[model samples]
Target: MSQIFENLPVKVAELPELTPTDLQPIDKRYLKVLLIMQSIIFTLLTIGGAAIVYFSPDIEPTLLHFAYACAPTLVLWGLSAALTLKGFKKKKYALRERDLLYTKGLIWSVRTSIPFNRIQHAEVKQGPLDRIFKLHSIKIYTAGGSQSDLSIPGLPEETALRIKEFVLGKTAEDGAIE
Candidate 1:
């Protein structure tokens, strides 16, 4: 006996679209967390630059020299802060019946969707900064890797836990989890 395989073509135009507006935005406080982290990093960079200029044998420790040494750090920090503020609005996520979706970016947008059947496990994590901000992040892992396939950050602690439980339940229902 012989079996024949049939392949059907899908109509691309008939598929439903996932628009940015359809997704829910992350917590607004995440922006504050990001700005604080950026400020801390830039402060350290500025201090290091100042020290280098002050101690250098070749360079005179003048106000002009200090300004020149720290100028690049200040400029870069300003640019980074601006981009972080602008890009924060672009981060959004959605939990659909069949899959989880996360989208983020300003200039280069990216959207990731993972179906329930492919999800092996989910976890909610909070760092020191996240704890201070009362925020949590959810990480979803699929098969074949120790690293999570997708991580959605800047969520309330309760929301993150709820999402993690939902994903785990879905995975179990789909027989992805034993």
Candidate 2:
């Protein structure tokens, strides 16, 4: 049997909106983790710069000269730390019955949504820093892609696992997987 294809136009005003207030914030400890990681990177850069200045016979190895050479790195590290702190508040996620949403960014905010049926797999990941802070991240991969469609980080270990299971279950119920 062949049926006629109907193209219907819908009213945009009647659609539901995802309020920012409803979004859940990531773990607070993630900020501390980020700051520590930034400091480690800054220290490495400073060490490398100092080594270059000390090894090079052409350049005079003075405390003032080393500080001058590292000024740019210092400025960059400071800006990054400040932005990380401000941007931490912007990282939030919400799981709806039909889809998952993640919002992030400070100046150029972005929100991404992935429907449950499109989800192929979900997994929980914890890096060395995340383990130290007892934090985990959930990576969701959808159909037509080898990369994860969404990654929500700074969640508690148990929370990340539970979310992953819930997403997988939803996909199964939708007949997205065998």
Candidate 3:
């Protein structure tokens, strides 16, 4: 058992080794904004929970005490979101000719590989919300439902199209690098 634990590989650091990487660089502001939104949500829930404890004198005799106990969930929720954002910032992605690799998620960090040849269709999409945020999403449709559509988000519009074209074998005036 100790030998098995010793053989486990060390984790890679998050800083980019080169100027370009396959993964979209999310603005750190996104994580910050998300943290704020989460905090607001927990604040609202905590307030509501306290109100229940104050107003419901009947249930307070029994089950309501547990409800009041759940008030601490607000702090737990906020801390959970904060920790998740930290984990997300530590992830990275790489695009290769044969396949694309991405790492995402919180405690259960996932590393997914989608082969380029298996990509059936691709598109560069931007909605009203995305446009407002100056962000773009590139969707790559693969062979199966498991990894069917790869949505690479928080990219610039031009970069999204370039990735779309690269997958489609459609090059721009500047060629593949553009």
RMSD of each: 5.1, 4.9, 8.6
Tens digits of per-residue lDDT, candidate 3, 1-178, equal 2354555474334323333455644554445445655777787777777667668766663565756656587669967887867775755656655565666777787867666766777878876556666767777777667445676665677766777777676322222342
Question: Clash totals for all models, in order?
Answer: 0, 0, 0
Tens-digit per-residue lDDT, 1-178, candidate 2: 0123334365544456677776899999989888999999998997888888989898899988899878888999999999999999999998887889999999899999988888888989988999999999999987776654888989998899889889999888875445
- The candidate, 1 or 3, that scores higher on TM-score is 1
Q: What ordering of candidates by lDDT runs from best to worst?
A: 1, 2, 3
Report every candidate's CA lDDT. Answer: 0.88, 0.86, 0.64
- What TM-score, over all chains together, does every model reach? 0.88, 0.88, 0.60
Highest lDDT: give the candidate number: 1
Which residue pairs clash in candidate 3?
A: none
> Which structure is stronger by TM-score: 2 or 3?
2
TM-score of structure candidate 2: 0.88
Top candidate (TM-score) = 2
Q: Candidate 2: deviation at residue 163, Å? A: 0.6
